[model samples]
Target: MTTAIGNPYLEGNFAPVSDEVSVNDLPVTGTLPPELNGRYLRIGPSPKGSGETGMSHHWFVGQGMVHGVRLRDGHAEWYRNRFVRGDVPEDSPNTNILAHGGRLLALVEGGGAPVSITPDLNRMSTWDADGALRAGFTAHPKTDPATGEMHSLSYLIRPGTEELRYVVMDATGKATHAAELPVSGVPMVHDMAMTATRVVVLDLPVTLSMDAMGRLAAGAPESGDALPMRWNEEHPSRVGVLPRGGTADQIRWFDAPRCYVFHVLNAYDTPDGSIIMDVVRYDTVFRDVFRGPADGPPALARWTIAPDRGTVSEQIMSDYSVEWPRINQAWAGRSHRYGWFGGTGPDSLRLSDDVSRDRGGSFEPGPLVKFDTATGEASAHHFGTGRVTQEPTFVARPGAEAEDDGWILSVVYDGTADRSELVVLDAADLKAAPLARVHLPRRVPFGFHGNWIADNEIGA
Candidate 1:
């Protein structure tokens, strides 16, 4: 569905697939672990039809489609991809998919309510925790391993005011608590960090702009790619630390560097009352190009916030430009030793949709990187030259004792074959060859976030 003119996101692997596929017993190259019995589910933008093409087709604002692989025993059972829509397809949740509170949900941020889907990817309907969620829900919600509760901060994408809401969903999928916090502007809080006692809010400088929305409304040429947000210089970049179960007035604010963080690897509190947050940081985003986040390459950085001193420190953990960080769910909101990331170079448009200019960023295939936060060392697994990978989901082995005792699964797209495969790697040994490769039915476009849902956690 490419057009006469060009938009980078609408071409190649980023282009949306038009068909809904359900294939059983997909081909496999190696053996799937007998203990690995669940589904590796991922969702991303998959716009329908050929009407929305060209530069106006922003990558973030597309219809969501869920792609999943079901595995049982040592067999690769099936692969399915379905649009994440209920009665109305426009408000489908497309950014992330996860199982929580006995319900499986497809999620989107910036004011869209989450939509529940069945185990087989069938659309169920809009979910609001039985009407408890009055505002929008965030795509990223940090689950507390101690209590199985999920916490998130939600805000409207097209905000007219300057406020955000902090919500806590209990283990039973009920909204336990919610509070409002006043802010400078409607900052695009893409993700938040959670510690044992606090939920850290990233109040960065990127904000909603009425001017950009006006351009899209007027049907301006090249405005098809215009996102409603821009890099706001007037907005002060800071982080808000709200105590667990505390009100907005008790939040402590500390200044941060003028940058953007799309994902937080993990965050935890130190004994001395400091917060350590690992994240993929961008120097700037939504700047000159209103299309995507191509202002600069994203680097893995750590931000240490000290409320007692009202100061924050920044340090680069890995300079190898990576994103989509995942760790063992057991270490969530706690100290962790290892994390997996997808590598992207300075080239490849730097996550930007405008490929009109020849940026030095390389289009070559990237490696799946295994990062050790304790030693600042990275080991990468290359998928050859013609292949690119999305986020790597780490599934720990049953009753595993070691932190790295698990399997890393990622969807790798091969440009040479115009196809995709699920690559499996021993989490402890990235230098070794893949343990298995599950051949998918078709190519899977680079998407946002996904999780490995075990059968015991939800069901088969």
Candidate 2:
């Protein structure tokens, strides 16, 4: 059998790291705040060594590795990287790293169960939520700030099943709600939105193509080089709202226009009973993509669902190419004014929405986008040329008064030097200089979501 010469995902900065290192008392530029006491942990896919390199390596598929910075008592304590166990066994946990039920969980939406790890970045065990979360779980699961309940719409692709499960787990590591929802075809449902009374699920145009999968399994050359999923132009786009803690049969489905959302910023319900949500929408996905993301760029869009009127309306907020919308987690499942995102500037790498078989082009991340939903404004913080950043996590100051009273934490990779630094910026003034920079020994490639686990909240 012959193989393609190059795959974009396996080359350049997207390449996997060769080793995991533990460094203590990393150098710091500015002062670390005393109130910021906890671990800033981020997870993403990173295959080990050159053997994992291939033309078929999608950015979304790899072994998951957790890179963390320990913050405690006004000092940057340590930085460590570890491979998550039990999922791919010898591969990547590459998706989202989360803190739930007193354990750190590594999640991937595609078909692997959550791999629980220790607070200090040690491998623990594969969890099924006490036999509650079966099949597999998604990378993004929303937790209710009011009730401490975790909600997930997990999907499993068997031979002849078109059903997915909606499972909810309470604070103490116990599964409380489990129900199955019907779907016509298997879609790559990456993320979901949670409101006070409902969890929003997207059934978009991108669905699994068994024909493509069969070709890959049958040793089709290019099948090993591209994603098996394809865009279904005829598939209707829609959103389903399931009542919090309600069974799958109770889900209310509303028709939506043709689009796709990979991550939701924040969502809430109006007093008039309409659900309002902010998401990063793409015109198409998995249709004519290169590595992992949608072929077209994404925008910050709003979707308003009226249960009484039986209509779902979408409003595009900003056309700036962006994804990975994050707000203060405390404001999740409720209304919030501000959110942060990993956005692209004018010269950033972009994908064409048209179909192309050959590997096309690539670009680095542009700026950290600070979006104000209330004022309809977006400000970008550029990190110089060849320097890219990942999803910015908002860390609220203890005893914070205003919603924007916090610091934004992100791992900024300097492509020139081939090194990474954890940059902290004032949440209120995103354009300002970094408040502090915790330099690391190596680069942490651009990856998925993370959390700032307050020391009081975890046993690290």
Candidate 3:
């Protein structure tokens, strides 16, 4: 079926310009790229400047705006203020550009890396209330899940210096706390994940010694080593879990192997007790290098965290790589179960792969696989090629529903003029052809994250 909807803001090429000027002292804001506008949410990449090289300029400020879109028809009726903002230096193309949260809790991040914070977007603008930018804050803020309050952490990087000075802010975007996190002579923080009570940071320690061959030959090493490792001190892929209201001394440390870069973590209460789905990028290098069978595939691992016992058990899921997996909102208060396409091995497609290559590089969308937590059975759907699918978002059928029954919504990038289509799949039997395919006029730009807002709660 086909339907046409008009975007008033998008109608006359009337693009929203960045209120802030560029780092280059230019008055013009870069193009307002078109992206998927969602109900109570919107995610897109805001470039720093104009032209091809502008897109390559990683230092450009990237913006992610989440607002309320009409659920009945995909039209943005109202918008929450821009929550996630960061300067993407050319080298760090993998930073997070997406933020996902609800009316009460919103999580914002800079690229895919770890500056994850919860922010409140449904408030009266400070400018509307106070009459000045001076009354406002400069840093992008995230919300604290435990307290349901907003907070922000700002960092300063000086020329020829590696340390990052940070300032934390309250809900009103006012600086409430401040500190400096030494990049240890490194450029920036790699990735981070958080829970209600703790902030987990994945800092990559800069290395001066060892050439490419020397580092690869040495493989992975512990913290304080010269090799390129995941969470080590020299390459500090270390995890610092600090209590929400506590001091740095209360931070707990954990070690990740050379190839494992931590992704997202979700707290779960299993029959065995509380555990966490500690997702990490496995067997992938941040830098572009030789691609061959030697490269390992990404995978996810489950870790049992018993705070009282102060013990952790690392149990790897046998067939799943730490690569990207489609995660749905947990049902029945259960932990999240991810679905995606591709084999769990060294050859798995990763985001870092070259997109223009004939082989279609690593980030190419693969098959559909569903993971069952209760059975631990990874089910593959319609294996092999045909429909190229990337990240898949899920929507529960309106009403109290069965666990296995819901609609799985995803954008299928068909690689041609009719570039993409929104396909709905049977959540229980993903192998079934799409229940519906909603065609689009233009290809929706590749996005990082999305969520489903039901009809009733929207347009209220």
The candidate that wins on lDDT is 1
The order of the candidates by lDDT, greatest first, is: 1, 2, 3
Worst 10 residues of 1 by lDDT: 356-365
Q: Tens-digit lDDT track for model 1 on 226-261?
A: 457888999999999989877888998999988999
Off by over 4 Å in 2: 1-5, 48-52, 87-92, 221-227, 345-360
Global lDDT of each candidate: 0.82, 0.78, 0.39
Candidate 3 lDDT: 0.39
Model 3, 1-460: lDDT tens digits are: 1111221111111122233211111121222112222342334333323321121112112334332222233322332334343223222221222232322222232212222223333332212012212211222333453343433332223223443323343444444554444445333343344354444444444233244325434653222122222222356444445544444456565554445453443444455543464554454443432221113455556656555455555656536443334444443123555444333322334335543122212233355566665567766444334445544565655452565567666555454453445555677787776665545333444334444554332222
lDDT of 3 at 426: 73
Scored against the true structure, residue 328 in model 1 reaches a CA lDDT of 89
Global lDDT for candidate 2? 0.78
Which residue pairs overlap in candidate 2's backbone? 45-94, 62-92, 63-91, 63-92, 63-93, 64-92, 64-93, 64-94
- The per-residue C-alpha lDDT of model 2 at residue 390 equals 70
**Mind giving the per-residue lDDT tens digits that candidate 2 earns over 340-378?**
988753433333422221225332356798888988898
Q: Would you estimate the TM-scores of all the predictions?
A: 0.94, 0.93, 0.57
